[model samples]
Target chain A: MLIDWFTVVAQAINFLILVWLLKRFLYQPILDAIDAREQRIAQTLAEADAKKAAARLERDEFERKNRELDEQRQSMVSRMQDEVSGLRQKLLDDAQSAAERLQTKWHVNLQRQQQRLGEGISRRVQDEVFSITRKTILDLADDDLEASIINVFIGRLRQLDGEALANFVQALTAAEAAVRIRSAFELTDEQQTAIRQVLREIFPADAAVRFDCEPELIAGIELTAGGRRVAWSIEDYLKTLKDSLGDLVREQDSSQGTPTAESESLA
Target chain B: MQLSPDEQVFWQYGFIKLNATIVYTWGLMLVMALGSRFITRQLSTEHTRSRWQNLLEIIVTGIVKQMKEVGLSEPQRYLGFLGTLFLFIAVASLFTIFPGYQPPTGSLSTTAALALCVLVAVPLFGIQEQGVAGYLGSYIKPTILMLPFNLMSEVSRTLALAIRLFGNMMSGAMIVGILLAITPFVFPVVMTLLGLLTGMVQAYIFSILAAVYIAAATQGHQANPDLATNAPKAHSQTNGISHG
Candidate 1:
């Protein structure tokens, strides 16, 4: 069968016209909307990216600050520890030095106290001895018979050696028999000659002598020859003086818990 | 040539024959359209001279500019429609040089169908862009007294486009056919040449009118009244249509 040219022509024209009309109205508006939507989407994506970047930067800054704070705190603690250590060492040194100084002071004080005590004790002993000697000397009288006897004995002392005679006088002054010699003996020539002969035999010639007589003796004759004195006495005054002094020394020694000659002699 | 008995009977039956020349012409027209599309695509390649690209750029730019003048919100949407219409009409005009090939646009039914599609689509688009009320209001625009006239004008313009394209192409085809039948050879050549020029001009006129009508319907008549009025004049001048 032959194709219809008229129908085909009519159809082609209709198709072209329809295509034109559809393009003018429907396609244009849809395309415009798509373009607007695309632009909006792009803008939203860009804004989101910017916000994310800002957040990351803020977090990084916070971390950095935290790290710095930690470092600072550590440094401060270390510094404090160092200072404390230094202070502790200094205190220790100061305490040690103070202890040493106190020890030295204690030692020096102990030595000085010991020396002072020793000196005071020695001075007290010397004062006691001097007081006793003074009391004994005051008891003697100038016109006493013992004084006359001492004067007669001293008059004959020129025949002795000087050193020996002085020693003899010291011994006579200490003797108990000298006191009896003053009262019991009126010197007869023969007795006096006999004492002189004994004195000459005991001492060197051309010596001066000093004699002391005590009346405390009951009866005695005493002759001082050189540095030595011989006494014959009925009284026990020497034994009594020795006994009292020994008792006093023994009492002192017993109180102090020390050994002495008095206690040894008594034992 | 000896005729067989069955062949003779078949010849005597007076059955309608397919016109070889008409088929050849139609085929040539199709080839021309396809070839033009191929050439345009090839010319778009990187190595082609800038002139071809410049030519296409000028055409696209011109269409965009016209759409802008018409005050369409987005002109790019209409590019595909305009490009298709331009290509179709250009290929349709080439039918003039092919003997016995009739342009499809020459038929009244074809033109009327195309016009009807445009008529229906325009109001639909207008209603979609603006509400139905707004679309109706546009018909009565400028003054209420001009409402009936404007409404009639829209229908008449669509009718005019159908009649114009059909009359112009059919007349050219009839003229060339009559000339070929009477003068067998030499005079027919002159008529064919004249037909080519007429066909191309008529095709261009049809396409431009279609573009103007679309621009008016989509953008609204009030958007650019001056441009709407001037578009048809420019079409006539370019196509050498001396409209009295």
Candidate 2:
């Protein structure tokens, strides 16, 4: 068979029609669907990426805030610790000051008690010495001790200074021209006469010596003339010694920063 | 059995003849068109797809991908021509495994018509891409003496394509026919299977050659500038794989 020109023309036209049909119904739609799917996937991925970035930023912010809170908590804790430490120090200082104050008050009270005890002992010693000396003098002396006491009284009158002599003379010149003499025992008449002779010589206007027995005088004598008195008692000397010893004790307590009381009693 | 389906005359008018070649070609075209429409009617882009949808997408994307690999950067622009050429020849050879069917591609007229389409398409695409003067100027390259040589090469290659496809398809059918008389059963079945393999090969070769031609024509198309740079290397692979 030869080449069929009519069939060739027909086949070519058929192929072109087939090409147009396939293009219209097959290739175009599939390609469009594929393109659409690709675009959707890309958009979803972009949204996912944006969400991931936002999550990361939020996480970072949370971490930063947590760190700040931690710092604040630490600062508060440290400040509280410092305050507690300061309070502890103040309490310790208050305790120490209280202990020292109690100690100082106790020491002062102790020193006062000690000074009072020393004063009591000194008084008791003076009283015991006076009693012993008075008893010994009464045992040793008989009639002479009283005479000696009278003689000592008269002697004291004769030894009076210018002011005393005038005072006595002025008193003797008055209507009461007598001097009283006190003794631990009764005086002899001779003793009394001697005292009167001394007085008359000194005063020149009277010679009256009145004698009296006062056993409580404790082997001592006293003269009273013109409303003036002169005494020689062992109690006065004992009081002087007691006062000097008390002053010494007071001075020692003061130098040692102690507190004590000192008293002077008239004898 | 007739060598060309055109020998089967169905009706006639004065110098206007209707033949089996025209009939089968139209019937094949109708089947192709209707099947494609039905398969694409409810297409889905989801992960789950119909088997038919899967098959059609595979064929279409495979064709587009091959063209792209061969340096046709804009593959869909040439998809219609190249894809039709491949399906036509493949379907033609494959239908022969059935009884009472003769391939239209076994005829010289149909093969020549297909070759002529390729010849016409090469220039049309070239002219569209680089303009007429630039495409014509490709011939005068290196010297003016190459103009006739390039022309002769174009015509000669087109004829080679037509005759080569015609002879191979026709000879395979002829050999099976001769074997049918000599040994009726087993050898003919074997040869028929071999023919199927050969037919699929021819389809692949035809599509590849057409792609190669269009790739050369649109070589300087600057839509994808790197495609022009890589085209020659891709063209050499095409040359290596080219058969009728």
Candidate 3:
């Protein structure tokens, strides 16, 4: 009695119509809008992530390049320092070599100068001794030394053996052959006659004789026939004195442990 | 005074009688249609919205959320059918605050029709979700001998849903009418307020029970998804009839 069939059918139809209307107007549009907004948000997040990744990559690359540049700069600076150090060492070696060569040359020059001074002093001493010997002999002779020397020579001619007398006569055989005599002093007439008598004994009586005075011989007599001649002088005694003096100087130098140094020739 | 909307027949043409139930149902439908049309005329997808549009959005969203909380994984799929059912019942109950207003849900015929709609929709949704063979396969579940009992259960549950709403609404109205007769002053007003609260509760209960049956028909979906998904705002049971 409570149920009405017509009303039930009517209400079901009305409910169905309502369902259709709300479906078309309400649910569809709102769901679509929400989905669209969610999709937009997802897209924005994805873009931001990509940009962040790219920026991180760029920053890493730049830092790597900067590190490489810094390393290269350090390497270059080290190389330059090494080069400069090497150059300094080389310059020092060259300077040391040059200084050693200059020292050797300067030492050689000093040696040469010392040797020259020694030679000059030795020559002056030798000349002074020679002059003193000549003056002493001249004062002691009182102008008789030349006559005594002639007389001694004449006597030595008389005592000669046959072979020696024959050699003296053989040298006088040239057509223009002559005898020349030199002495440290002038000869007198008596001394010349005696020298001529001694020569007559060995050569023809017409043989010419020439006489000359040479002070370099010190005090000595000299003889000549063609290119043959004989002489005597005080210079022989002076040479013996010089040899004895040189031996004394060498012995003193050796005892004192002095290194041998070159000396210029007194000659 | 008429005990039911069915007995308050305004136009009777032989076996076919036009009653207060049909008229009021039509009037409620018209009001719903016109209001929706005006509110949805110029909808905007921008941030700003008209007040009516905002109200409609709240209602539609609330219904969709409720349907999802019930069991529908895709709430929008069931929003139209379920939302209309809820709106119709709630509107019928709510308009009672006005003088001389009678709710269509108080009529046994209207409540039966609503239950019939659920009964029809259950198999249709079941067949759509699962094939005809699969849907029919649910009857023989637990044992092959349970097929007749399952069929009986389906018919019995539909009848129960219709009768429950009718009994609750009609009893409230009857109690208020009786109280009006006895005291006729402040007691009737207090009973009317209590009746409104009961009507709203009944509307919510009827729709949720219908959703449970539909969820049962669908199978593989939870009848109350709040348990499975751990949703916080779960609907508490007024009566435990929805356990099926």
Candidate 4:
């Protein structure tokens, strides 16, 4: 027989045993290893993805912070520029005001110095004119001129009109002191007597008369009774010239749109 | 000249006997068990692995893939029985390159035992898949008049499985032995190489057929629709090779 019953039975049992052995050692372990390796690879990939996401988040945060910082710096720079410009404008205003004050002071000082110079010139000119007029009057003085001056004074007193003649008559009537006369030159006794007779004739009262000589009268004469006086002098005419000259200078200063202290006071 | 290794009995005691088929089968078993145990002892789950581990994994997975192709949806359930059958036959034929060796599959007893295992496994798996009544009812499928044919088919196919493998393996060994006697040279070597090819083909055909039978028993037409088209083709091809 080609087939042995015992061997067939033995081989079948052997085949079964081989199946068990292979299942235990071969299939289970290899399959398990492959599964494990696959799981590990999947986990590693997941971790890598998580790390990449975290890194991206961190990068975004850093960029945002950088943007914020840049914005802050720009704002600060803008604020600084604003402050600097404001300060510069302030300084310019302060300097301009200070310069204006100094210019005003300098201008005022120049005006005061010019005013002093003008006043000195006017005083010097007045003194020279008075000296020359006094010298000419002293040189030209004589008895005949003295008689004409007395007659002119008498004529001027007689020519007093309306309120002037009435005020003079009221003053002579109310006078407690003697009537006084003053002249640039000393009067002669006849001239004095003549002035006393004119005063008596004008007053028509019992009035005392007195006579005086004054150098500052400068070729003019004056009469007084109590506090009342009537006088005419070259100085009066010179005062008119000085007032007109001061007005002219004040008008010139006003036209120029800068009235100096002297011109302001003069106006 | 012995037509089967079973005839080469080493010892006998009444009804019990020892022979080259049993002994060579044990030797193959020992080699497989010990080699599997040694290589699998330090199995690495990492990417890098030993060439032996790689080779074993390829063979095991290849068997799994083949079972799946043959319409066994769950190949792992059948891997042990079907994979053992292939490895035993393939290893037995491969050892033929060694001098003074007779492959165990050349014995009708070993081939009969392997086919008996397949025959038993098919019903066992079918019963596991669909209860005992469901599996038994398949015998009378379509009509009760076909019951005898179905029973006979089961017995006959088991018998065919045994004879097909036995004839191919025994003939290859016999031809190589006879050629060695006549030429004692390169012709037998060439025949031996051709015998190896035949052995590998027989192993594939046997396991694929077993898987098909198991698939048919367990899932019937409910399984892969392509199984219906493929089963007859496999059956015809195997039949052609056996007849040839």
Candidate 5:
């Protein structure tokens, strides 16, 4: 067989050209797409990371604001509570002062009323005593010595209970030794004897008697003994003076409807 | 009998047969190698590495990766042998189109010598990676009873590789030659084209089988038992039955 060099060289050249064309058109493009896709993916990942960081920052800010607001609200509530408590204390103080003032006023009024009542009672007692003294001096003006003495004794006996009358009679008997008599007018022995007989009959046997007389007694016999005295005086005829004074006081009390005891005592 | 002068002279010298085939085929193979290298370099220059260099690197890397996957410990030590085997077979097939050339790989003596080199190198590689004791001990695992079968398989495998390459190439060449003598010219053209195709195919088959054999020998007794045990190594050895 003879060698064929031409055909072998031709085939080798054909295969080489085919390989170069396939590499240039096909493989390069596929590799470029792969690199470009990798770059785009990296960029997208970085963008997503940045967004997450921003979201986290915003959330932290919101949490911070929320915490501040909660603290502020707590402080505000506490301040309001303090103010309410202070207001409550003030109101309590005001109420206490008002109560004190009312209590003081009431006490003053009560003390004033008690003082007035005491003064009123004292005045009435003094008036009653004065009237009793006047009546006693007026009773002595009766004309008949024995009759008057008997009448006085009977009246005193009617006013006194049994124990008082006994005390009075005992007092008269004890003073009998000191008996004395005086008169502005001359007295006859028979009249004296008669007065003595009457006194002896009215008094107990051991009773002591004393007598005194003044012309100013106004035609009435006056008798005096120990601390007891009887007089018949023209002053007794002036009983209208006390009656008028009592009527005047009653009229004043009725007209003013009995002024408060404090006002009356002040007057 | 009266003879023509030309016929008498022709009969006296037998026939004028030229043995330019080997020279032409080797030349063609050199051209193919240069062409492959040039095309690869042109494509590779656009990138950081030349394509031929890159392809060479890829082949080395792929073999290494396969070796690692096959669990060989010292792939670099055996890489030269496998790489040479691949290139020789590839170039021989591609250049087989030259009219007078015959690939030395088609000869039994050459293939047997190659297979013997593989057989010898496998144990050496195994022993270098794993001591001699470990290499021998690998046959008996998971049991000692497997040692005999494991040893027999190793020897048979090398024989298979050698016989398969020789028988396939020799038969292809003989069939094409006989066809050419029977019908010259047009028929010879058909046979030549067929021979080219067959030559390339046989080269690829032989190389792949060599890889399988080397892989199995290094990987050990357990490697691909299903295909290795059932498949026939040569055409005459199989009773005219196709395994695939």
Candidate 6:
């Protein structure tokens, strides 16, 4: 009584149709959408992972290059330091050598200046000594200084002995011309006879004698025969005094260790 | 008052009469179909979606999960038959809050039709999973003498499924109707609320029982041994509820 066969059949068909309708409109589309969204999310995640890996690689490469650059800069700085040190040492050596050369040149110039000063002092001493000695000799003696000088020269000739006596005797004997006598002043006839008699007594019997006047002897007398002469003059004594003063200046310079201005000029 | 929607005839041509049961069933069907079509018209595959689409997906997936729990390997394959059963029954019961709305499920004809559909679907799905011979051989399981008992069990369980749903839905509607006459205001509203709760439970029980039968038919009961044992226990309990 509760069941209606016609209605049951109709409801069963209706339910079946609803099943088909829901499956088409609802389940299928919803399932597909979910699947699509999941796939899109997965793809995005994969791409993000790839980009992360690439970024890591790039960072590593950049760090490697930075390390290499630091090493290169360090080496360059060390090399530059080494070159600077070497250059500094070379400059120092060049400066030292230049200073030594300048000192040596200065020493040479100092030595040349000293030599010129010594030559000038020597010349002045010679002129002053010669003039003073001639004046003193003429003023101190009451007789003519030229006659006194002549007598002193004759006395030196008479005192000759040994080799000097032999050489003088041989020169007078071997004369090709007459033995000649010269004096700073003119001789009177009596004085010339006296000198000729002395020469005749010392020479061979065939030897001849002559007399002449010369003034360059500076208050002295000379006898000449066969290119040999016996003479005395104030010029010889002046030369001996100049040599003694030069030896005193050298000894003083050595004791002092360094050259004073006077000692350097003298040297 | 009519005890069932079947007695309320809208049109008749002898044995072929259009009744309240058929007319209300069509209305429910049309509403369900149109609602699904309208919501799914511009379904977005994007992250943001319509709230209705969300609601629908939740419902469909929930049904799928329940079927899966029943040991159905691929729940989507049986989704059309099983999901519609729950939706149709629940929707019919839910419309009871409206004045003068007669739920089609309160009629024995509609419940029987749903149960018959489950009966036919069980064999169809079993035959689809295993050949006809393999499916038929299951009746003679354990011995040849058990074949008659197995066939009787199948028919009885299908009868049980139909009558259980019909009794729960009809009793709730009938109790609300009888209470509305006696108390009129407060008691009938409370009973109606209670009827709604009972209707939802019956809808769940009916659909779940249908799924269990399908699972057993397809030989998937072995997959989840717990479900296998629990399903029959629930059947016996619900059978007690229906008898009372």
Which candidate comes out best when scored by DockQ?
4
- Candidate 4 residue runs with Cα over 4 Å from true position: A91-159, A163-214, A222-230, A251-267, B68-73, B137-153, B237-244
TM-score of chain A of each: 0.43, 0.62, 0.59, 0.80, 0.43, 0.59
Model 1 clashing residue pairs (backbone): A10-B110, A160-A207, A164-A226, A168-A227, A179-A214, A179-A215
Q: What C-alpha lDDT values do all the predictions have?
A: 0.56, 0.77, 0.75, 0.84, 0.53, 0.81
> What is the lDDT for A17 in model 2?
90
TM-score for chain B of all predictions: 0.70, 0.89, 0.88, 0.96, 0.63, 0.94
lDDT of 5 by residue, B136-237 (tens): 777887699988987897788677766665566555556656776787668767766665666555554554454555555555555456434423343223
Q: Which stretch of 10 consecutive residues in model 6 chain A shows the poorest summed lDDT?
A: A256-265
lDDT (tens digit, per residue) of candidate 6 on A1-267: 999999999999989998998889878877777677778778878899999899999999999999999999999999999999999999988987787667666666766566556657766776677778767754654346656676676677667767876777776666666777887667767667766766665554556767778755556678887777877866566667888867765655455435544543453
Report the C-alpha lDDT of model 2 over A43-150, residue by residue, as the tens digit.
Answer: 778999999999899999999999999999999999999999999999988887777666666666776776677667766775677677767876876777666666
lDDT of 4 at A112: 73
- Which CAPRI quality tier does the interface of model 2 achieve? medium
Q: DockQ, in order, for the candidates?
A: 0.06, 0.51, 0.40, 0.69, 0.02, 0.64
lDDT of 1 by residue, A1-267 (tens): 112344435355545544544344333333443445457667777888898899899999999999999999999999999999999999998997787677656645654564455446545654575456434543442336444544455454445676865676566455522312232334555545545555556543433333344545433346544335445443345455545655665555445433333333343
Q: Which docking class does model 6 fall in?
A: medium
lDDT at residue B179 of model 3 (Cα atoms) = 88
- RMSD to the true structure for each prediction, in A, is 18.7, 7.6, 8.8, 4.8, 16.0, 6.9
Interface RMSD of each: 10.7, 1.3, 2.0, 1.0, 13.6, 1.0
Docking class of 3: acceptable
After superposition, the stretches of candidate 1 with alpha carbons farther than 4 Å from their true spots are A1-267, B1-73, B231-244
lDDT of 3 by residue, B1-244 (tens): 7878878889998877788888888888888877777677777666576788778888887887877777777767677778888888988988887767788999998999999999999899888887798778877876789889889978987888898888888887888888888999999889889888888778788777777666666763233344323321222343443331
Candidate with more favorable, higher TM-score: 1 or 2: 2
Residue A64 error, candidate 1, Å: 42
